[model samples]
Every structure is written in C-alpha cells, then in structure tokens.
Target: METTFDAADFHQTKLQNQLIQQLAAVEAQSNSTWATQQGQNSTRLAIALNLI
Candidate 1:
C-alpha cells in the first residue's frame, strides 16, 4: 500500500532544517570566539614567562 504524507510532516521537516542551521551558525561563532580567546591567553602566558 502507498502511504500519504501530511502538511504537519512538511512543516516539521522545515522547522528541523531551520533549527539545524541556526545551531550550526551558533556553534561556528562559539568556536571562533573560543579560538580567539585561547590565542590571546597563550600570548599573555608566554609574555609572562618571557618565552617570547
């Protein structure tokens, strides 16, 4: 037998895609910020230890 899909399923799929995209954007931004902070901290530590 053939099955039929509903509007609700389509809406749910769209919402899921939107949520996934938003999450990916936020995660990328967070990773960028974390990397920047880590680099800054490393520089400060090196300066303090006269390594550079």
Candidate 2:
C-alpha cells in the first residue's frame, strides 16, 4: 500500500514537472516570435521613412 502511494506521488510530480517545462517552452517561443515581428515592423518603418 505504501509503495503504491509513493509510486502515484512520484508519477504526479513527474507529470507536473513536464507540464511546467512545456509551458515554459511555449512562452519562450511566443516571446521569440513577438520579437521577430517587432524587428520586422521597425525595419519596414525605417524603410518607409527613408523613402520620404
């Protein structure tokens, strides 16, 4: 009985850790995408200004 409970707890902890890692990865990817978009917009604006 004790062993079973321990195993369940370990499994739960492992799943939680995996979930946190996945969320962090997603957040990082989102930030990277946003940064890339911002950089592109800035470049376009600079080009437009130069055209004027």
Candidate 3:
C-alpha cells in the first residue's frame, strides 16, 4: 500500500524553506557589513598610531 501526502503539509514545508533562505541571505548581508566596518576601524586606528 502507498501513503498519500497532504496539500497543507506541502505548503508548510515550502513556506519554511523560503523563510530559511531569507534568513540565510540576511545573515550574509550582516556579516559583510560587519567585516566592512572592522576594516574601516582598523584603518582609522592605524592612521592614528602613525603606522600607515
């Protein structure tokens, strides 16, 4: 015998996948922004220390 799948279950799964993808994208953007800020800070510190 074969089992049947429900439409609601499929829809819920799709929605969860979409949310996961969106969260991953947001995380990547945040990390990129943080790295950029760190680089800028390092540069400023170097200039202040007269090491650049």
Query: Which candidate, 2 or 3, would have the higher TM-score against the true structure?
Result: 2
Off by over 4 Å in 1: none
TM-score attained by model 1: 0.77
**lDDT for each residue of candidate 3 in 1-52, tens digit (9 for 90 to 100):** 7577789889999999999999999999999999999999999998999964
Model 1: per-residue lDDT, tens digit, 1-49? 8587789988999999999999999999999999999999999998989
Ranking by TM-score: 2, 3, 1
TM-scores for the candidates? 0.77, 0.89, 0.83
For candidate 1, which ten residues in a row score worst on lDDT? 1-10
Span of 10 residues, lowest total lDDT, candidate 3? 1-10
Better of 1 and 3 by TM-score: 3
What ordering of candidates by lDDT runs from best to worst?
2, 1, 3
Clashes of 2: 0
What does candidate 2 score on TM?
A: 0.89
Question: Model 3, stretches more than 4 Å misplaced?
Answer: 1-3
Clashing pairs in 1: none
Superposed by TM-score, candidate 3 places the C-alpha of residue 38 at a distance from the truth, in angstroms, of 0.4
